[model samples]
Target: MAHIRERSLTHPVPELRGHGLLLRPWDAGSDAEVAEWLRGVSDPGFQQWNTPLNPVTDLAGARGSLRARAENAANGLSASFRVTDASSGRTLGHIGVNEIDRTFRVARVGYWTLPEARGRRVATRALVLAAHWALTGLGLHRLELGHALGHDASCHIAEQCGFRAEGTLRGAMFEAGRLDAFRDVHLHGRLATDPAVDLK
Candidate 1:
């Protein structure tokens, strides 16, 4: 596979703005950001779909998580963004292009919307913004999105973002709360050559 010669991300991550939203890097020093991060990770809906390797249950954990994301961005391994309302500047969700493989020019994507933002297509809009940046701005060849099987909402979002359903990954992810248990994942992919998705 042909890969982009430049693999590392820029030191200062650029903000993605469009679709009435802004996708910016998480700030670890902001108390409000930390608080929202705590609420987002601790949300029941988020927990139902994602089992983060470094779980965040409190303020300290939330700070650590945000710092880790910063480190990853600096090292060019990932680009994580806080999805916020452009006009109000209120955080609505999280989206990230994770586990980036520079050699292959590919990465995995993940996202979650807070309870208050669930009904407004927050996740979908965020994914669309992130996907465009990952493919074009970041010069990645492909971006993959995987959700635990039966996650219909995520499936819909992936489809709307132009990530084609690729295949099923068996025993691919840790079950909701159990690291020892595994579950199937529905994998989706969007290549740089694929047609762009229309934003609603």
Candidate 2:
């Protein structure tokens, strides 16, 4: 297949609205935003399948982490968004299209929902919106999603967002809470041309 000429991603990534959810950039200065961010990152559920490079254990660390994500978006290296309710504006989760490669027209996507937002398909809705923006507005040729093996929820969300199951990546990521331990990852990918899946 011929490569679709990719376009440059805009600085200050645009907010995505749909599926009754809003995918917007993290507000580093807002106290509420920072608090919610801290809560999400510090949640035990988040720590289960993922190990962040720079962990956020407190409010200060949350602010710094949010700043770093904003910086990454500014540098065109990645885009991280806070998932929220479109109408209520309540913080629901976080989703990011990271490790963007402009030359290769590809990027990896990841996300987590807040405990209060669990069991409502919040992550699935957020991923669908983010994937659409990354593959369409950002003009990426492909998007990849990976989760620690056994993260069934993440695998389901990827499939719901049209990301096809590719294969297992052995020891692809650091095991939760331990850098020395390695965990297998289930890798999934979606091309820009792939048909969209229903959000329901």
Top lDDT: which candidate number?
1
Find the 10 residues in a row with the least total lDDT in model 2.
1-10
- lDDT for predicted candidate 2 compared with the true structure: 0.88
Write model 2 residue lDDT over 41-131, tens digit each, in one string.
Answer: 8889999988988888999999999999989999989999899898999999999999999899999999999998999999988888888
lDDT of 1: 0.89
Q: Which parts of model 2 have CA positions greater than 4 angstroms off?
A: 1-11
User: Which regions of candidate 1 deviate over 4 angstroms?
Assistant: 1-10
The alpha-carbon RMSD values of the candidates against the true structure, listed in the order shown, are: 4.3, 4.4
How would you encode candidate 1's per-residue C-alpha lDDT over 68-102 as one tens digit per residue?
A: 99999898899888999989999999999999998
